[model samples]
Target: MVGQRQFDERRTLDRAREVFWLKGYGATSMQDLASASGVLRGSLYNAYRDKETLFLRVFDDYAEQFLADAAQALAQPVVDQALRAFFDFTITSMTTGVPTRGCLTTKTAIDTKADGERIRAALRDLLDKMERLVHERLSTGEARSRLAIPPAEAARVLITMTRGIVVMERVYQDPERLRATAAALIDALLTPVDPGRRSQTG
Candidate 1:
């Protein structure tokens, strides 16, 4: 059986993550965490040492969940299918049901202070992992003919495009716009490479 103190600590961290996810690190206060976590301020301090430490725990949890979802999306049978699943997951998660806190990493990236730097670094690590997943899925020989450009370049472009879509969806709240943009991106991905078009025939 878990000790009372340990159970309370876990509960506090879970509630703290929700608060941080909703309000962001810069905006959230210790009072807010204490209230949201349903724990007294003294106990929160005892468990986490401080707000920064608590926020780091929340950030770690967020990164783990995001990467796990991405991994599942990338696990489809084919690269193009995997890419589509990945984008679809992002769109559906952002738009479906009640609007929850949007991407926590994107929310925290603009702060640029100490905690912000930590959050940004974590986000970069997540992006790097995502890019690697994309490269692996696309590097399969069967995926070659479907791609207009090299797998590495396409992965970079696709990831950038997907991130951009998330930003737009966060701001605009237009599902159709997001869907259209994603379709256009997929069309571009499906376009055939044209090396000959770059040459000066005249």
Candidate 2:
């Protein structure tokens, strides 16, 4: 029987997620994880195989939480309000959040090595999912009426703009600036386009 004193996998993964989110994969050593997780290095290795494995697990958890939050925001009755909530969340995450390590996926991608390709790919996939969610939310006639571009193209633009905002906030450390940028981006998204022009293309 498993002893009560035995460490919980879920708990350990949660702790590791915080640690990695606070520190990038390369910056976080096994010793740091051991200390943060309250588990010995040998035990961590035994449970997770290696640092990479542990990092991947943590990444998965982060991605899951991100997607869940975005989905909740998208559930709002007004699509524009939902999109604003999404941007607000992004700004809040950048200015606050426990890790302060910037976006994990972007950070990892910038410094990826041969072995880190899989991690990069996972991050890309998550972004793709987000883009799709945005596209679906914007595809409705009411939402499309407020958009300057097609639903698919507008989704892509919003994703890119939001990612850029996050990156800028990380470097600038200015909450007001970030908020202004977010507002501008949302305004651009909410600007009405000509239905006649859209019909011409159709």
Candidate 3:
């Protein structure tokens, strides 16, 4: 019985996540969650107390999955391969789904109508985790002389590019173009930096 309940909860959260992604926090309601998840409205209220609380739970679930995916992508022995894996995951997330729903965190960050401090806090926590994960990977790569860019600088560039990619994905909705852009950016960043040459400093 306990196992079944746990499975049901996860199923509900997955459906809830889809609804919330399709319709922002402001628009989604208990009825929306209930209908999408096929769970009783009273059951949802009893489990999560309120819509905000339920959304937070769903958001946390997303955070966990996102972090795990990042960690997996960065686990490759070669830095280049690791980065490619990460970007491939990112691009897949952006391009997948029926209509392609960009990114949850990026959309949440830009949502001006999204109320409450808790939502902002959740976004911050997830973003911080991502920043740390990317930075750690880059730092390790730099130490091993696998990357020419400084970890701190490269982390900032990569994170910023991630946000930009999210935006561009929505605007262009072209998987090929997005992949091409990411490839070009990776090539530029990975180019060897000659310190002795008096041309230009990176």
Query: In candidate 1, what are the lDDT values of residues 70-92, reduced to their tens digit?
Result: 88998897565777788887777
Q: How many residue pairs clash in each candidate?
A: 0, 0, 0
Q: In candidate 3, what are the lDDT values of residues 61-160, reduced to their tens digit?
A: 9999989998899888666777778888888986778888778878777877666799999998987788788889887734346455777777778777
lDDT of 2 at 189: 70
- Candidate with best lDDT: 3
What TM-score against the true fold does each predicted structure earn?
0.82, 0.86, 0.85
Q: For model 3, what is the alpha-carbon lDDT of residue 9? A: 85
For model 1 the TM-score comes to 0.82
- Model 3, global lDDT: 0.81
Ordering by TM-score: 2, 3, 1
Clashes of 1: 0
Put down candidate 2 lDDT per residue, 1-202, tens digits, no spaces: 4434358778788888777766777888889999987889888887777888888888888888888898888777766688878887766765666446566667676654414666877888889999999999998877887887789998999888878876787778776787778677778778754678769876
Q: Between candidates 1 and 2, which one is better according to TM-score?
A: 2
Clashing pairs in 3: none
